[model samples]
Structure formats: structure tokens, C-alpha cells
Target: MTSQASLSVTAETQENTLTEVFSLQKSAFQITPYPSLTERKHTLQLLHRLLVNHQQNIIDAINNDFGLRSSDESRIAEIIPSLQAIHYTLKRLPRWMKPKRRHVSWQLQPASCKILYQPLGVAGIMVPWNYPLFLAVSPLVAALSAGNRAMVKMSEYTPHTAELFKQLITDNFPEDLISVITGNADIAIQFSQLPFDHLLFTGSTQTGKKVMQAAANNLTPVTLELGGKSPTIIAPDYPINEAAKRICFGKSLNAGQTCVAPDYILLPENQLNLFIDAFTAHFQQMYPDFAHNSSYSHIINDRQFQRLQQGLVDAQQKGAKIINVSDFAPDATTRRFPIHLVTHTNESMLICQEEIFGPILPLITYSTIEQAISFVNQQPRPLALYLFSHEQDLHDKVLVNTHSGGVCLNETLLHVAVDDLPFGGVGPSGMGHYHGQEGFQTFSQAKSILKKGRINSTQFIYPPYKNKAINWLYKLLLR
Candidate 1:
């Protein structure tokens, strides 16, 4: 008991240390003057170098945390995309920083209007457990490219991965420029409340609201990447096999822990069994047997595992059908849980109420496209919405009727990979986007600049608003 107490106290002390480091970094940024464009470019280069050097360590750490994530999947999903973001920013930074010209009215004819891109000082990035490295570091890249210093707080759920990321930053860079913070929620709360110029959070919507409230005390700008129950609509016109393959791939990978994963299916009523059979066939082919495959990742932790368990239970209690997809019997060594297919679940059930961050997918049947669109419209916008339809008209219908952060037509959950497209959410799914050029804008502020020759057309309106000449000038220019 005494030893256990000591261990608990030691853990608490370590958590406090992380918060203190973040606070110090914030203060340092506050004291530093605005960073120059050259400096921003240098920071991005350093970040790119770090990612290249520590690729394997990051992959291994993620694997250790989540059991065994696919090596190629982790690299392509986490690092390659980030490196591309860096390269995209590097190639465009000069152009992006150029002052944007604006039309000045003829009344101010001698003046040229421009908008200068400026940094927003220190930025705090709170990363979620899923896709820890990519989500956190990617945002840091944007902040740095925009000439803002960043303090990253990696989720403690993946403690090993979190520590590895912190070490990577500490070994390569000074804490004043960039660093990783690792701790539990209380310490996260302390770090969140610090007066950073801006804060970027990627996590659940419920906690996102709390982070916003904390940052609000200082009126700090925020970018929230919250997850919602993203729905996938399988248009009756498409091939069931192709649609199933993509849908199952997105839903089964990392056991559907991905925020962008299709949360639930909105299928045509008559085609429910056809879609299920195709989906089940794909799921079987992917694993063959989940009882002993080390390639499959387990739940993040027991707490999360229990939550997944409860969601399945809730679906069952609410008269939802369960279609278990695993040959593995329950055991400790292979903590691999099967995916449940719970159809006809009400919105009150856990499967519908919470973001089902697991393999379990709740399939809802709809007779008409309008019904599915209406149901989806009533919910908060999702991170990504998938529509499987070869027909252009149905695709067009889905696009016009429903709202999401982004969309993938005739595909499932891969639109975020396109660096040219802005990746983020709307209403509830997320706020602000960050991937390529959009990311640069997310962290940059445009300061208006007006350059004028020695000609004052508006001088007559300086103090006296009633001057007839000024009124004539105002009318002519405004018109």
C-alpha cells in the first residue's frame, strides 16, 4: 500500500512537470517579437527533418500503444501526409505571404490597398489519442509555417507514444520553439487555460466545448477538430461489392477508431441484406480469423474497450440486431473484440448518442433518399460523409441535401488525403481546416495595409462630415 501510494504521487508529480514546461514555453513566446518569414520557413524545415529522422520510432511507439497498426498505413496516414503538407507550404509560402491587393474606391485613388499575412504568436495544440503524431505535428507544422510558436500536448491514453514524441522534440529543438507535453486531463486543463495566442484541439465534441470555454477566459482564438457520428449513404445505383469494400475498409481499420471513419450506414430498406452480405464478406476476407491475427489493433485501453462493450450492450437492449463478425472467442491474450452490426437502433442508444469510435457499426435502413437526407440533416454536421453512387444525379442530390465538413462521392473516408482540399468540419464536426493552403490561412492573420501617394481626396472629410465637397467625394467614390 505504501509503495502504491508513492507511485501515485510520483505520477502526479510528473504530470505537473509537463504543465510547468508548457507554461514556461508560453511565457517565452509572449516575450519574443513576431517571427519573420525566413524564421517560419526554417522552423518548418526543422520539423520535416525531425519527422524523417524519427519515422520508425514514431511508428513503433504507435504500434506499442495500439497493439499493431499497419506499418504502411501508419506511415502513409501519419508522416507522408505531413511531409506533403510541409512541402506544399514551402513551395507556396513566398506567394502566400505576398500582400493581397484590394480595390480602393476612386475617392482614395492615390492609395493602394493590400492585406499582409501576420502570425498569431504562441499556439497550443491539444492532440487526440487516435492518430496522435500526425494530428499533433501536422497542426504544429501549420502554426510554425504561419510564424507562430507551438506547445503540443499529446494524449496520455497513448503514454508510450506521447513520451516518444516529447523526446523527439526535446532532443532536436529548444523548448522555447517547439515541444511536446504529456499528462492526464487535469494537467491538460492547466495547460489549456494558459494564455496562448491561439489553441487548436482535435478530439471529441464534448471535450472540445470545454477547451473552448477555458481558452475563452483569455479570448484566445481556437480551431476545434471535433468528431461526430458521420453517416455513409450507399446510393442504390452503385455496385454493392465496390461500395462494401470501401465502407468496410474505412470502418474496420484500426477497429474504426478513426474520427473520419463512417460512423453508421444509411442504406436503402430493400437492400439491407444485400449490403450486409457484401460487407460481411469483405470483413471476413480482411481478417479470415481475428482470434490470432497480430495485424489487428485492439482497443486503445481497457476503459475504451469497456465503452465499446457498453455501446454494443446498449444496442442490444434497445432491440437492435447484432451481427458479430469474428471467429475469436473472448480471452485475455487476444483481446480482439468482434464488430457488432446493430440495425434499427434508436437515437437514444449509446451507439447513436456517442461517437462510436470502434468497429461496431449501426446500420439504419431508409426507403427513400429524402428520408436519409432529412435524418442526416437533423444531426450535427460530420467530419466526412460518404455517398456510394455511380449515378451523377444521386451524387448531386446527396451533395446538395446534406452538410458535412467534407465529402467523398462513391468512396469512403479518403478525401482528407488530398492535400489540395481543406480538411476540417463545419457546425459540430469541426471548425476551421488545416491540410495545405487552408492550414496556412488557419494560423495566419491578414493585416490590412494601405499605401498612398501625396494626394488626399478624403482630406475634406477629416473633421467636418457636413462639407458639401466631402459629401460629393463620398458619394462618387462609394458609388
Candidate 2:
């Protein structure tokens, strides 16, 4: 068997080579003329075509890895998002890449100033397995648009997908532009430690900490997309059906595995019973037979499935009520997971503290929306917050007061679909934003340029603080 450090060493050596390749690319960026709009658009077109060519393999790989993902989910969540990101980048890149005009101060006179957007050389991206195809391509599209050479470390959980990505790169893109790294966690650890100009990682908070630490070795700017317990709040005033439908859509999608998925709910005590009833009805409606419903996804693997199982078991043992939300008879379905509910859980329980990234949603009742807000504030900031209330005031109040990666007003997890908005978390939820402008800025750097006038003026200010002309000018400016 190979030693633990072997993978790390191999990755380090490989990263060094890739870094040099990107350095040359950067040199080319400055001298060989920047990519034309048509060229960039063509690149996106090529990427889209590549995605379509591998559609069936992608669907099968995703199905094998996460049982919960269906062709529809992959098409919408992965393929379509990638296509949309390409479209978004294509439409906006010319404007985005244009130099931004800067205001010249009166003191500066005829001198002009502008801000230039430059690629950040090579970017090292570490993608998690959840939305392997989309998450990888979404950021890659941004990086490519920003004119940065990219290196991606595909998650080990989805080997088929990773292999497919490697094949695609091998077939189409030159290694000097972009490359893929595929292996286990050892390789990931090493990849993170590379001297990339910038790095982006999408994973758990624990893993994110490790990635940040590794990136610190090179003072590499990092974008972390981590997960925490995101809360969904519902007021008594809202239509219960609407709340249930939206919340259920989020929770049931990917079997509640998304980083922005609603982990738990905070609601009025009187509405708890009714909310659960409506949610159960919605879940049943979505999955008439959860066991075999092709649309309903399974937990990633046996390890995650076991962890979800243990979390529910621990909650049940701690005096929490387990609401059975699955409607299918056990014999009818191949899926082992059931929709589990735990109410009255303590703060210290596994389900309460950690992000419950499964279909099991815990419930907490509050006397008022204020209590719900307070509860959320005490914990680490979440990646997403879902609020359900017809009252515009309550929605506005939460929007103003709460800190989160993003907010889904009066619904759950739909805001991320809005391509105009940036998707990311703050604090424990995550440390950077991506999508739209945020994605572009993350992958590139802002370089400010100041033009000098033909004649040098006020040389008196350069050498000493004692010059009368400079002193008089400074006094006049300050006063």
C-alpha cells in the first residue's frame, strides 16, 4: 500500500508544473493580445457541446454516487446551470472585461484614471461531490471568462464524474489553459497546499478550515463555500400550503443535501402541528412512493446514510418526537431512507448542532418571530435562511437584521436560481460569494491605472516636507 504522504507529494509536484504553465499563460495574456469576445463566446459554446456529449454518462454517474439525483435534477441543477452560466458570461463578459472609467480629482488635473480587470493567473478549485458537474462548471465558466488558467480537484466521491471531466479536458482544452486533478482526500490536501494565485473550495465547514489552512501557505486568496444549519422561519399569518410547498421543495430536492438547503424550521407553537401536517401531505404528493420514486434521491453512500441514521436515532433517544413523513410501504421501495422528524431535541444532540444534510428535518417551536431570530443569531451564520410570512414587515425586518449567505423570502432555496444574485455564505456558512458579478470578481483581480499628465508639476512635494510651495498647497487642500 502507498504511504499517506505519497499522494500529497505527487499532488505538490503536479501543482508546481501547472503553476508554471499558468505563469506562461499570464505572460501570453499580457503580450499575445487578450481574448476577443468571439473567442470567449466560442469557448463557452465548446464547453456546452462537451457537456451535452457526455450527458448520459453524467446522469448515470450522478445516479450511482448520490442515488437521490435524477436525470431531471442533473439536467436542471448541473447541465442547465452550466449552460446558463455560459450564457450569462457570454452576454456580460465584454462589458465586464472593459476597463472601468475612474473619476479624476480637480487636483489631478488633465490626468486620467481607469481600473483594469486582469486575470488572477492560475486558480486552484476544489469541488465537492454534491453537484459535481454544475459546481465544477459554474466556477470554471467564471474563471474561463475572467481569462484565468484553472486547475480543478474533483471530489473522490464521484469517480465516474471526475474521470469524465478528465476525459473532457484531455479531449478539448489544452492543459496550459485548464487541468483536472482526480484522487482521494490526500490529493485534495496536497492540491490545497499548492501555490495558486487564488483558490476556491466547496465542502463542509471542517474541510473548509483545512483548505484555508493549506492555502495560507501561499497567501493564496481563497473562496470557501461551506455549510451550517440553515433555518426556515414561518409566521402564523402565511398560507400554510405555500410555506409547506416551498420548504418541501427545498428539503426534498437532493434529499436535503444542498449546502443552502433548509436544515430546520422555527415557527409559531400553534402552527407547528398544522405545518407538519401540510408538509407531510406535500412530501407524499411529491413522492407517492418514496421507496422507489425515481425523483426522490438517496443519501450519498453507506457512511452518510449511517450518519443520518445515527442522528435520527440519537434524537429519538433524547425525548424528541419522530414524525414519519414517508408514505411508501417498506417493501415497495429500494431506498432505505425515510422522511424523519425530531421535535424537542436538545442543543447538544448531534442533529441539533451539526448540519443535518439529509432528508430528516428537525423542528423547533417559537412563541414569536423574534424568538426565532434570536435562536438563529446565537449560532454560526448559515449559508441560507428561509422565511415564510405574508407580513411584509416581518420579511423586511428579518432581511435587514439577519446575517446569512443568502435569504429565500417567503420560500425555500429558490433565490439561488435567480442568476442575477450572488450565491455564497458569510461566517460559518462560507467566506466568499460566487455567481454573477461575485463570481467574475472572485476569479479576477481589479488593477487600477492612473495616467500622468505630460508635464511634471509640483516637484516641490517629492523630496522634503519643508518646501513652502507644497506646504501652502497642502494647507489650502486640507483647509
Candidate 3:
């Protein structure tokens, strides 16, 4: 057989397998749709143990996928957060499982209204290549906590991590309970087309649209955790040195391959040069000799590395000054693209036009705070917005006027670490939230139910609307 035909046959076989697994999970969910709180907690415990036991393996897999993924970064950004999420969910699962008592109107006396959080059968999670483990496990934690079976689709770009994760899951869990899917883009398309009860996807906005479209055919509700040009603003009052240090840490972590990483900076015009100098010093201190530093991370692959390099070139050709903060050259073999600050960027530049998912930060200066806010408003809503300021009025103004998935005042990227705060985006950035309680609720269906005794008070108005008692009651109620 020809190579193309063989590949086609393989995809067809995988699709058939996926369909069989989906049916098995669906049938299993029907048998035990709502798992008890203890059962859910036990499942979470198993996941927690798996992550803790295989920490080194997980880190090594991610490192192999990326040319050089920092071990500490993987633990800090992926393993630690996943473990924390599971821990937090386990502690709160009992309370979240309780049916919420809702208010019943006076006219409906002797009746109780409550919302039951029921599992939504099968949930589909599409994991992104960057931060593969956390993105996959975080949502799975929520899904299992809500008592739902899940089928996760791991990114093909991170083949090593995907294969290891699939193996670990297959060894530990039942196929009908939690199965991991690994394949190329064709498999991803087939995976998304599955008739899931609820689907959650995390990736670029463009790909998010495709996922949503496929889910729509099944009438499936979707929670899209998409990426956009997340912006950071350094206020005039905040210390430039401190702001630079925090921004450096956020952007340099994972080599700026984060969905919530600060994409560009909006600073006061007069402080641009000072901020640039401070950012350079802080970044250098954070990762000295970053090109050869094992502490630093590399781009996930050459495609992403080349895209970032070309973005810098395009910015320079369009009259933007490219400032290499680390003063290190790009290493093609290692795929380590040094951090470059693009100044005097215009709308025509690729750096300004798209989400730079690499170590490329574009700096846009404004004359006043209002101008800064305006500039942000002009762009589509982002997944995250950061402002470094001590002024209460400034914080309130930015919060009131701007729209973003989440905001971190005087900080960057740390908000996601908080277990209580719900994380999601608005408009173009993405839709729906999945974090603490919000996550459980997103995966579960809120079934509204009303309970009453044998007494049928509603019968009074059921028939013969012309009755005097009914008229009086209507008048009284209306008044």
C-alpha cells in the first residue's frame, strides 16, 4: 500500500477504536452517573498519587519534547499546580456535592427548591502542547470530582509526554473511566467530533473555533480556554525595578510559552528607557548566560522558534527597534530564542498583530494612563491583564474599564496559582471558567428541582380561572 493510503487506514482504525471507547464510557456513566463524595475523593487521590509518584518521569518527558525544558519549571508550573488542584478539590468535594438550597417564593410555601449538581456523563478535554501535564490533569481533576468519565486528547507536538501520560493512565485506571487519546491532527479532529456531554478545549483562538464548531454538531456545550495578546501595564507610581523583575519572571518562565504570559508592555512614555534598562538587568540576573544556562527553557520545537524569529525580523523591517534584553544570539540547534523587546512597533508588525507565544515582548508607550487603558480597550479582550500600581483609584479604574479573563494587580501570572479564583476569558480570548468550584460546576449539570408534600396548593389556580378565590389571590399577589 502507498504511504498516504496506509496512514488513512490507520486513522480509520483509530476512529473506530475511539467510537468503541466512547460507547463504553457512555454506558458506564449511565450505570453509575453520580458517584458518591467518597468515591470521587478516592479517584482524585489516585490521580494525586500518580503525579507524585511519577514526578521525574513526567519532567523528563516534557524535557524530551522541548529541547530543554527546565525541570524546576515543570514541577513549579505543572506538577505542583496539578497536585494542588487535586488537593483543593478533595478538601471541597463534599460541600460541592451537596445540593444547594434555593429560595422558594412565598406563593410556593411548604415546597423546597434546590439545584442538584449531577455529572454530565462523558467530558472531553483537549490539552495544549505547552504545559501539557497541568492543562490535562487540571481539567481531569474537575471532571472526576464532578463524577464524570473523561477522554483526554493530548497534543501531538508533545509526543513523549503524550505517550507517557497515556501509558500511566492505562496502567492505573479503567479504559471506560478515564482514557487518554494520542495521535496527529486527524485524530484530534475525530476526537473533538465525539458527542461529549461537555467539552473543554485549551489552545489558540483559531483552533478553539474549530473545536467549538465540531462540538456544535453534537449540540455539545463547550468551555474554550483560548489564548490572545495578554497585555501588561507598568504604572508610573510603581517602582520600575520591581515591575521589571516580576514581568521578567513571568515572561521568562517556560520561555514565555504560557497562555497567560504577558505578550506586550504598555508603560509611561518617559519611563520607557528606564523600564527597558531595568528589565534587561533583572532578566540577565534571573538567567545569566541564558543561551547555555540549563536553568532556562528552550522553545518547544523549531516551528515555534522560527515563527518567533521571523516575527522579530518582520518587526525590524517595519521600523521597530528590536532590543535583545539578554544580549544573546538565537541558537537554531538548541531552539533557544533570546528575549527581544520590540520598540516603536506599529500595527503592521507581526509582533503587534498576533499572539507571540515565545520570548518576544513588544513595548508600547503611552503619554497618560487614560491612553494606556484606551490602547488596551482597542484590542480584543485578553486572557489575562496585569497592572503594577499601588494606587487604589488606578486599580479600580482599570478593573472597571477593562475586560480580561483575569487581572493581577501589581503582579503577573500568580493569580492562576490561587485555588479559589476562577480562571477564564471573555469574548475573543475565550469563554467559560474552569478552576475551583467553577470547574466542578462547569463539568456538572445544575439540575433544578422542586419538592413538595401531598398537599396540592397549585391546584387552586389550575382550573376555572374565574373563581373568586383565585381572583383575590391574583390581586393580592400582583399588589
Give the whole-model CA lDDT for all candidates, comma-separated.
0.82, 0.82, 0.93
lDDT of 1 by residue, 60-144 (tens): 9988887667676678788898888888888888888787899998666778999877877778899999888889877887888
Q: Which stretches in model 1 have alpha-carbon errors above 4 Å?
A: 1-34, 329-333, 463-468, 474-479
Local accuracy of candidate 3 as per-residue lDDT tens digits, 273-378: 9989999998898888776898789999989988998998898999999899877898899898778888999999988889998899999999899999999999
Cα-based lDDT at residue 59, candidate 1 = 87
Model 3 is weakest, by summed lDDT over 10 consecutive residues, at: 286-295
- Write down the TM-score for model 1: 0.92
Model 2 worst lDDT run, 10 consecutive residues:
327-336
Clashes of each: 0, 3, 0
Return the candidate ranking by lDDT, descending. 3, 1, 2
- Output the number of the lDDT-best candidate: 3
lDDT of 2 by residue, 391-446 (tens): 88888899898999998878777677777899888988788888877788888889
